[model samples]
Target: MPFPFFGDDKSTIARLLSTLPQTGRVEWIGLRPARREQLLTVEEATAETDRHLTGDHARPKPGGKRQITLIQHEHLAAVAGFLGLAMPLAPGRLRRNVAISGLNLLALKNRQIQIGAEVVLEITGECHPCSRMEEELGPGGYNAMRGHGGLTARIVQGGMFRVGDEVRVLEKSSA
Candidate 1:
């Protein structure tokens, strides 16, 4: 037998993407993404990470902004992604902003996800890895993630995010 609400047991989230360097310890928090404005197309949302010189997982603070190494299923738009590999690839262990074990990243393209209460995100495009992978993940990490490098999208609406929240991928398109 199998459970229903649990969805796909093979599917996992927030597995771990390297703990924020000490003082910056931010927990798994939440997995989400959004569009800049209600009108921005999924294409625009995918490029939102370009604003981040550092990489995906960037955040806006009081004066400036900081880049976040990891972005979950929805929020990936803001920072982009490196790759989504099936752990134990080789060399050392690497991490991802969001843990997508069961669902195929491509399957969600141009789709909207309902994460908990009202956090909705539009799957824009794929998140490819950069040189950073060599330093963070193991030597093989970069090659392992290749094309299936997670996803990215902009924030359509603003709200709070927390870990352990239930995420529901909707079929209708937000565009």
Candidate 2:
């Protein structure tokens, strides 16, 4: 059985809370063309509206809710602690594409945020930790990343984004 709270709970507060836009900066970028492939660290990458990164394996399904993934640099330590890891966790192992330093990814859910003044992305939802977490992060890895798994987003407007790019929330008219 699934957890009760995982299902839709239509409440005003829930709707209102997630609508707020926030800002952050791009700290790192990574790409993997296929599953189990080595992560390629890049200074910049192009985001396409029809597909993910230029070489990512999965395509946005019919709904196109997940064109990219982003993780907060701030949560690395928290996830590491949960797994009892002494060293800092690597973002590549998490299989996310972009790592941001400031804004809370969760807060941007369903909102549009611009990256480096070129690309715009809409936060789709949480990127749940996959079973691979256990294999890569060790025994308790899967569980440790439960709520800290990062976020999935779809590219709204495609453009080139590089490391050290400033990320900002887009106003309704601008988005």
How many clashes show up per model? 16, 0
Clashing pairs in 2: none
**Distance from true position, residue 77, model 1, in Å?**
23
lDDT of 2 by residue, 32-117 (tens): 98878867888999998746888677677644888899998888889999988887688888889999988988877887889997
Worst 10 residues of 1 by lDDT: 36-45
lDDT of each: 0.39, 0.84
Scanning candidate 2 in windows of ten residues, the lowest lDDT window is: 12-21
What value of lDDT does candidate 1 attain over all alpha carbons? 0.39
Q: How far off is model 2, as Cα RMSD?
A: 6.7
- For this target, which candidate reaches the highest TM-score against the unseen true structure? 2
